[model samples]
Target chain A: MVMRGLVCLLICLNVVGVCHDVSAGMYDEEEGAFETVSALNSDHRFWDDVRLTLSHVYAYGTSESGAIANRSSLRYEFDTTFFKRFSLRLDGRSSLYWKQDHQAGVDDTNALAQNDLRECYIQAGFDAVSFKAGKQVVVWGETDGDVINDVISPRDEREFVFTNLEDARLGQPMVSMDLYSPWGDVFVFVTLDPKVNETPAPGTRYFRGPAGIRVENEKPDTSDQESGIKWKKIFHQFDLSVMAARLRQNTGVLVYDHSDTYKKKYPSYWFYGMGARYATGSLLFTLDASLKRHYQLQTVDISGRYAGSECLMTDNALGVEYDAGGRYTLNAELTHRHIVNDQDDLAGVKQDTDGLFIQYRRLFLNDTLTCQYRFYHQFQEGHTIHNGELDYLFSDHIRVIMDYTFFRERNQRSYYWTYRNDDRISCEIRYYF
Target chain B: MKKTALICLIMVAFASAAAAGQAREIMEKVDNRNDGQTVIAHVSLTTFRYMTQNGKTRAMEQARIKRMTFVKKDEGPREKDHKSVSILREPKSEQGIGFLQYDYEEVGKETDQWMYLSALGKVKRIVAGNDNEPKTGSYFGSEFNYEDMEAYNLDDFTYTLLGPETYRDTDCWVIEAVPVLRKAKKSNYSRQILWIDKDRDMILKAVLFNRNGKKTKIIMSGNIETLDGILVPRKIVVDNVESRRRTVLLYETIVLNRPVDDEFLRVRTLTDKGYRERKLQEFKDLK
Candidate 1:
């Protein structure tokens, strides 16, 4: 019954503008004129790029429990020019979700409503230099589904890989400047509010802990700002970039208290990374590597030994993308990580680990229909994940998407094995205006 | 008698040389006349798909609005390169979509293309061996392909002056162009015949022949006007003979030699909505 009401509400909101305009002018002339003028002046030519999107998603686990999750969201984006050289943009989303009970005690009914301001920024260009301020997202890597050099922006991992990577990115408040030159572009950024990745709630299926334990996040002070610099250039046939930053460690150290609660403490770290892309004919090759050093609790081990340790980690990834004719693309990446100064007694902080990711996409029917398949394999943990998606455009304003995700593990010790039974299928309908 | 014959032979040789020289000169004039440092334009495209059912003719129409900018650079004495970006503005579903292209005038050099999809919020580089591939999606289901919209370079083809002709009550120079060996290996068309308006120094009509020497397409341009001392075509129609499809492009506004900032042509403009809008506004204000 609640689902029916929500559906009706969404439909009404889709056509509310037309209904409002018709009813406003039905019986009054002066009132209609006043409304029209107000609308015209409010939505001036400068606001012509405003856009809105509404989507409803239904997801269900393919298990005996038959858990279902329904979500609806409305997103709005506006972009325009203020002065002659300055540009301003705003984007926001409002979402609602309802999850059905999987078991008697697992109600999973909390924080059903949410609102987020994704990005709001203003930028100006002056000859060879440009400056941008406000909340924004900055990505720094070329590999797909890899996080080596792309650690600048935080992510919302509540839904894990089920969510689009770009959508999962959370913006940070920052000021950035770019200096353009013939050789390359030099960029510097200072972030005031650096957000940490949001993990799944304690009671959720993706949560990783015992039932009685609670998690508390301790964000750093606002005065502890992060800074980064990047230099990017296209030389010959290669696109190259190098960056260095001082950042708050994304995965904080977990300190367990007497009451079975864990406090997440974020520490400061230094990161340096570099990446390059070279394209030849229909194939593109990419390489990225980054090094980070910090102190953190060794959370990966089942045994609670080496709980606190200072270590340096290096991650490197090599990827290739091949484009076959007829709107088909394939991408593959292999990543390797190495840790230094690890405690010998700890089982979690392995000296070396590797991961591989692959993705394929094909478009049909004049690009109105799209199909994609992706696979991720963690070699050290022997865990694999498979995701497939189908999207069809019903018209210019409406689209339908279906997705299925599966996980497999060689052993129960792998982290992904915790959700081996959480395989799910999802369907979504979207309207654009 | 021998002396007179010798003189006649020399005269014939001089005349043939003059004809060849004139052809090259005319081609150079066409090239120089069409080249512009920077150009910005707003265009409306309407495509008509024709079908026959039970001896009845029916047509389906699709409309689109786009803003395009083209910038050129001289690579060397014989080579030039062009960078062009097209942003889709209308049909709200496809809004914020953009295409960026880098075209090199030298034969055998591949053209680079990238598409920015706003829904995915990512820019995808399209890697293709040649620009003649039909997989570019036919310009929104129109008869015009990406190669048809590309700027022509004189060095890629060899042109021959057919003769002086009159087309549609206007005097024109008929010329036939065959792709060079390097270009022919990648091009789908065997030859193209152009009807150039002598007075305006612009192409008014063109007929394209497939690799099999069959007439495949016809393009007609009208509504000629001059902007910034350059001849511009306000309207164009392309008819595909095989598919019986037609595409019409109407230019709402055309500005040439505009003060377009080099930064506006960067890849960031394709992915950054605010930057794209600001650059577009600057281009519009120029008009």
Candidate 2:
């Protein structure tokens, strides 16, 4: 009942947002003149390069309790450019859920399955400066399938990593400006309201803790603000960038208040990061490093006990990509993270962690079909995730995709081991116009 | 006999000097005719792939459209640098895709290329084996590759006057260009033969040979039109002899020496549709 109310509220908000934008459009003098000129002089219209895509996805998987679950979703995206210098985009999705048995303790139906507004943004550009305002996503970093320095935006972890990382990213309401110059491109962003990553709710199948354990979420006030700046430049065969930001961390740690209850607290922190890429011949090398001050996280012990802690953390990653031939590519990356100035025992807390990622892709049939495999492993915990996908484009506007993912852990007490039994296979078809 | 030998030596020396002078003069004319400070063109490309099925010939076609902007500047007395951006506009799947290139005429320097993938909304730097290697899949699966689109650098190849001939009713100077040792290691073609129009100072046709001395590709340029004091080919066709595939590029509009802002060449323009379209509008009417 509560989820349905939220859905209805979002619908009403969307309607109001559309009406406001349409009313605001009438006051833009420059855009109006530009549209008139375009219509009079050329075949070009104010609305150009409009694109729409419809997609359907289906997945069948078994939970840890041996209950079979089926999930289906329909998604749509609409994008169009207007007045030569402005664009508007929208995306939404609806889904259906089913389970073989209601006795498995998981809900057989989801009331909020059809409620999602993925992205809505308006973009405009001038001679040297460009602006984008509304709900949008800004991505930073070069490594594939790994998060080392990409911390600017929040993410949705409700479905875990099964969804494409790009798709799982939730847009934040922000206004951003990019100033282009020969020396470098500088970006400034101001977010109106801070947003944290959304993890699975307490009653969902993906929830990690024991059932009946109450989970309390403590979010920052809507008035809280966040901002960031990034400067990127390209010199000869090298690309480099540096960024600094003050924002609340997307993922919060859980603190066990007592035996049967936990509290999730989101804390704000400062992050400084730098990244570089150099290309030579068919090989490209990348490096990224970031330092976070006053990082807060929860650590889990072997006995499932959780404790909260705060410390400074440093993360560094190096990656390389090689094109073997016309149809094959290989990529690998190594990341190391360490906690600084740690004074507590924090037995379950990950004071140090190292991870390696490898990926291989091959294309066939004039690049109409692509097959890819990716593997990620954490050194200390012996946790590994393997993913493979095959994508085929049947035509210019239609594509089919199939993917499988598996998670494993050598240490049964590790955090990743909690999902070892939830491997899944999914297929999707997309039509673009 | 001694007098005769001296005379022969003098004649041979004169011929060698004349050949070298002629080659340099022809290259200078070719360069002068094609060089421009800035150029923008809107083009339509059609690719045809032929196959023999059941002893009958079959053909398949693919079409693409793009707008290209090029800028060249003299960096030094002997050095030239160029930057070009090509944005794809047709074939909905490839719409908004873009390629940016930086080429330097200095020896031992490699060209740089970056590709903007619209689907990913990201710009990726392309690193090939050499300047001659294709940046992507044969320039949209056509017979032409990325290297084929680059303007020729006189210093990279040694030219020989193959003599005068008439091709398609036009008087032409046949020239053969062989890559220098340093360039041969990076080049895909062992030698290229050009049919330069004697009057227009443009290459009318070209034949490329592989390292094994086998014919690999042939390109023909036609429908020459003078625009802004420069001869521009309205139509260009490239045929791959090995695969029996061909690509034809038709220039719908050609604008030379147009004012192009430096901001239009930045990475942001490639990723931002509005920025790219706005910049392109500056030259859209050239057609």
Candidate 3:
């Protein structure tokens, strides 16, 4: 009778679970594996045991284009176990942005705030089968540079190392289904809004683009699907994964014009791509190439803005990473995008652009300290630019970062324009419990 | 002053209640367990790593031991009085002979530890303590402390009977124990809740909590054996919750009141390597 009562009491507490991570190390006296699987956090004493964390960061930078920007963000996270085979967590972030208006030309220093419900998920286990669903981060690929399934949400890209989501394309408030077996794992996601709006052509306008650059309209009814599969073992250590996705727009028409007010109606924003990744211990390799076909407005008879062009574009990316014990890690990657059409050169400029990135980091002071250097170069024949960044982790929780970006252009007269540069200096502190 | 006095009184009342419950439970169980002979057993130790420095790490294997001894209490001095010795070998065998000697002391808590290095040709004293903190700190880096293997002392901690429960198959009284010293923080458990068998006063299972109030380790006792009417646990298993690690102790033999000589337990006997060799040789020669 006593044991039965105790078990019932534990079950009741599990239903109305309360979890508060004590301020102690993971090796607590009551050390049992913590697991979670329910939407309601219950059975805390039996399964809930983990740390909670909060962080904040602020940064300022001036670009060669004379654009000065400042940004800050605050983030909070809660993770805990519920029941013996379930776990759940929530992460939230809010950011503020401000800019200086006068440096080179356009001046707008309005501060803006943006926040998204990042991830809220629960995991469950039944015999050998387990499932996790809700808003969650789907991380795939073996390279930091070319991620495939990382498409949960867009991140701030202006900073050197923005704590943003990688595959911003796929994680669009979607419901995901996962299946696991001894041989491999597979998962699929369904999104409400599938198509991602593309950048407006220069000298053209959009109705719904951010900053009123485009006419804002309700997202078209299009089914967005993304999924991936992974094989458990390849030569005992190697892991392999493949992923793909597609989205079609069924919304209102988009129009582009040539008189700096040109408009075009887009029937759909459709893209499909496949990616592959492999990893072995400290070494990782990734390759992702996708073809994109989009509608573009062209000047008809050199006068009207209604002439249209359907351009076929291809993007290729390759990334490699090597971790040399605890001493250093080196990563190198390149991305090339090409528009396959006679009009690839639009208005006397090549539309094809290529980008390169290389980064090296060293962990000294027994991993208590670290230093990193990164280089980025983007090119489109006449317009070539390079950016450099250096960061040092002064301690386990503190970091100092520096970035310099250089821009250069060549005129028809073969004269090189004055070099334009941007730089930023910042420091941040982080702690976990 | 009135509030302080009230708070002090409340604390005193709670402590007294806790003590009364513990004493009542202990008395009920140990009333029939007086003046019983205790027996030591020879056993091999094995442990499986469920946790490592890195997460989800594990390793497993067997250990090596050179010798083991049995000790007991009696009314009068016999041939085997006060003589106890055990040579523990290194877990991973190396090129030559490498072992440690556990020299038992009579009527005291201290146990002398001397390690023999084949290259040195001498026995080196590695540890000397009253079988308390030092012995309990480490034993071949396994989870079991020396105190955990010895007799339980009431003075080591304050115990309170929370209630009763069934542990494995035994009906037991649930007791909560709080260590007395500040340094006890480094022990496997910050606090312990044990389910002691109501009939034999043997702990059937103990749930250890971390300083953070989380359950971290579980120790279960099994395979009871009786020697001169004293019940003893012949096997024990310790499980680390977070690391998924486990260590099991199984004894192969148990003996009590065996024939042993006093001279064999002397300090000189421990130091004389030739004497040890000659004694073993004489035993072999007798057979």
TM-score of each: 0.83, 0.83, 0.44
The lowest-lDDT stretch of 10 consecutive residues in candidate 2 chain A is: A30-39
Clash number for each model: 0, 0, 48
- Candidate 3 differs from the real structure by a C-alpha RMSD in angstroms, to one decimal, of 25.1
Candidate 3 CAPRI grade: incorrect
lDDT by residue for model 2 over A319-366, one digit each (tens)? 999875254788899999998865364656667899999999988755
**Who is ahead in lDDT, 1 or 3?**
1
After superposing candidate 1, which stretches have Cα over 4 Å from the reference? A1-46, A63-67, A98-111, A222-224, A295-297, A300-308, A342-345, B1-29, B52-58, B61-79, B107-143, B159-176, B209-217, B240-246, B271-287
Cα lDDT listed for each candidate? 0.71, 0.71, 0.45
For every candidate, the chain B TM-score is 0.83, 0.86, 0.65
What's the lDDT of the predicted structure labeled candidate 2?
0.71
Which portions of model 3 miss their true places by more than 4 Å? A1-58, A62-72, A83-86, A96-114, A123-133, A146-171, A194-214, A223-237, A248-254, A257-284, A293-311, A340-353, A381-421, A431-433, B1-287
lDDT of 1 by residue, B48-115 (tens): 45565665434543222233333333334653677777777654567778887777776556667777
Name every residue pair that clashes in candidate 1: none
Model with the higher TM-score, candidate 2 or 3 = 2
